[model samples]
Target: MNTAGIGGTDATGTSLRRLADALGTEMMWAGARDRPIGEVVIAEPGDVLADLPGALVLAVGARGADAITVVRSAAEAGAAAVAVRAAPGEDGALTPQVKAAAERAGIALMGIAASVRWDRAEADIRGVLERGAADGTSGHRGDLFSLAQTVATLTRGVVSIEDAAHRVLAYSDSGDEADELRRRSILGRTCPEPYLAHLRQWGVYRRARTGEEVVDVEELPEMGARRRMVIGINAAGRPLGTVWVQEGTRGLAGRTEEVMRGAARLAASQLVDHWFQGDPGARLPSRAGLAHGLLTGRFNSGALAAHLGIAPNASATVVAFDLREPESGDAVSQDARRAEAAEIISVHAASYRRSAMVAQACGQVYAMLPERAAAPSSEGLLTRWAEDLVSALRHHLRTPVQAVVAGTAPRLDDIPAVKLRGHHGLQVLARTPERQVATHTALTASLMVRDVLGLLDRHSEIRHPGLDVLARHDDAHGTEMCRSLLLYLDAFGDVGRVAKDLNVHPNTLRYRVRKAVALAGLDLDDPEHRIAAMLQLRLSREEPGTSPFPGG
Candidate 1:
């Protein structure tokens, strides 16, 4: 079958790596990650594939043993890739035979996640090819509302798009013909949980989640809900924040199915763009495993790099960010807030570096700026670009953001050590919010201090006895003993500066300091006591939610 993509390996050709990276690893696991596929064709159940070089042949409805046959035939047909689908619980990785077929025949095998509609996967893959041909610029990117409007026009029904959690992302303009469910979902941006429970109770959600078929859910008279057809939007197993589409119209099931199926694919393309381009919340958990592994040094670097389409030997810069939310904002989920910051950074990253990839882990979002080996040393350039990212985030989010740009170009194998350095820098930034952006090189002293603080955190027994008397006294008496003492200690007994900062006479500050020292039972005359007292105060300030990667 012809797809709205290239028919040969020419201008529209896309590498398997690009496809996997664009749509995410959840879409398909390739036997080989490097082959270029220009065309997408769906194979009937019994078709003997032949003479289809550079084609991504979708073995639709072919599973188990039949899928194995399609793999072998794809090898004979000179296809660039053969895709097969699997349900949620099935093993979808490449088999030994499939691997051999690809190795010998230069045809990679693709294992499509069960929940993904074949049409969606095809559109997603073809989108990768067409977009690549257009110099990585997509004409129809990130427009779900328009897509929803088109689906409404085709199905003659009111349509709405919601994430799997039932948060409505977009909807089509509609008249009173729209059901109450559609109206509520669009207005509230959430579906009623009880009605969703009914979908689960009748296995409607499961069918929508696991199948490409548009689920026909009849009206629940008891609940006063009207009839609607729904489909689950998933790129892969991780659910990608899950997409749930609803159509509320009558007498068009047979015809609407095909149109809705096409709509699902188009929506998948847009969501995939959101997922990769900037929507950190979508399918993040599914992709987070590998990202976390690579960032934390827990996973095999080479394998993770290949899976992420990262070149192991490529020199790369990793930027760490800490987005401190404003004091007050509307009630939004943490994921939503994180995505907002990440989306802004992602926009800057994409514009600055074509090879940049963004992911979230350690309660922080990271942008991996991949640099080619032969590229000029991006010493000053990367830092400047990162500064722009921080500025953009600050302006757009109206939040204080600290961005730490790693100076050393670390390859995959060095990621753990590099991530550690940046992680320490972030921890330091959590305490010092004055600096907007700091380089890893400049954060050396702060990073060490932060590391020592971490040791105290891990070994609670090593934690110092804080200034309990002074803190409690200030709390009760409305005094500023703790603040005065910390400012005095931080200034190295600079009484004038501390007094000016406190907006008080120097002698008044001196009196308060003396009283604080006496009350806290600390000897200010001794240097050891001064340093120990400062450490104690700093440690005391290290409370919950203060760390950069808090609860990471």
Candidate 2:
């Protein structure tokens, strides 16, 4: 190995040979004298003691009978590492004794018989030094290499700054890409002034055209907050735009700052580059108007899909991300500010191999998958992809986000209609606080139960006027649990048994059965009464409570 990499320069071969002779070592060859010691060995002589350390090297001639003697000498010399270097192609002649002796000394012994010249040795020294520098970065040289590999993999398809926008750019090697990711998008349309101002005051404020601070704005808009997350558009610590962060979370604050700085640098560089090259993309249309148009087929899906390289018959899915209400300090209006939001949404969708489109009508964006024969049917896949998208957007946007899905479809033509249906699903989501999806499966399951109850009502002989009232009360109150209890009781008032099967306490179970009986105005022990209660619960589920059941 070239000792140059270990911090040594090439020394005169005659001098080295003289030193070797004085040290009672063989001269080996003429090449050994001129070989460069490009790296300095930091062993300090004490680290090179006779005991076995983590590393050992035993350099020797390729086919000499003294090879074993050289190995034994290195081990005895306290070399923790040993490498047996022989004349080219002499490795196969290495004996088991050499291996056993090295193993017994707890020293690593590698056999390499490649003929080395000054140039080869010098190159080896440089590689060794580079490896030493890498070790100094963290002692885990392997981990650093693995991290670099991962970063390469992650950034593999990253073709442009546009593709890098929403990704957590990190050097998976040195965590550099992580910093790069944070930096890449923080800088927004308005430059260092707005972001710098936001960072200075630590609250939301607007930056005037002249870069003057204006604090009169009630709260920072979502875009402002997002921009702040990306690139603290602050100048002299004064915010050019407003900034808001979750209070008391110092780690998040630091992360936010890192993200802002990285974003600012990337954004500024790109902005300058764009200025020189001339930007070609047009301003985006209003998402609300876009959505309304798409619903009405005013937006040409085929033309847009074709432009995006999507096949006509490919399957797709629509995802709707709903923004959270402005927190205590947010001043952005959803209708007027959506370009950044749309871009973020698009970036995230693209991460999942989904082509993104923000429709204007209901503030919903869809990532449609094209070119596939049949898209995924599971809402879980869509929901997971949506969550990941939202999270990535949040790092740059820092606004509250919620998402809903309309499940995947089998064809592109089905998206607009499916999207319209998805809008209705969004209404249901808005009416509730759940973040889980409301898809065709959930909707169909509820509908099927209702239809079954409708059939029972129509077929039942309960010919009583009060039947309608009983049905409505159960419709309002008797949910899946009540219906389940009625069925269980009908099996026989086997209280202890039903409780065990349902995983509930007996008394808790009895109360529910009694409650069901009272709600239905039926006697549990009576066959006709039990039948009526069952029919009532079933029928109530069918008639949406507002509808009048014909049988009743």
Index of the highest-TM-score prediction: 1
TM match of model 2 to true structure: 0.37
Clashes of each: 2, 75
* Model 2 regions lying over 4 Å from their true place: 1-283, 286-296, 324-343, 374-380, 390-402, 427-439, 447-552
lDDT, candidate 2, 117-175, per-residue tens: 32233224334434443333112222222222322222221111211112121111222
- Alpha-carbon TM-score of each model against the true structure: 0.44, 0.37
How many clashes does the backbone of model 1 have?
2
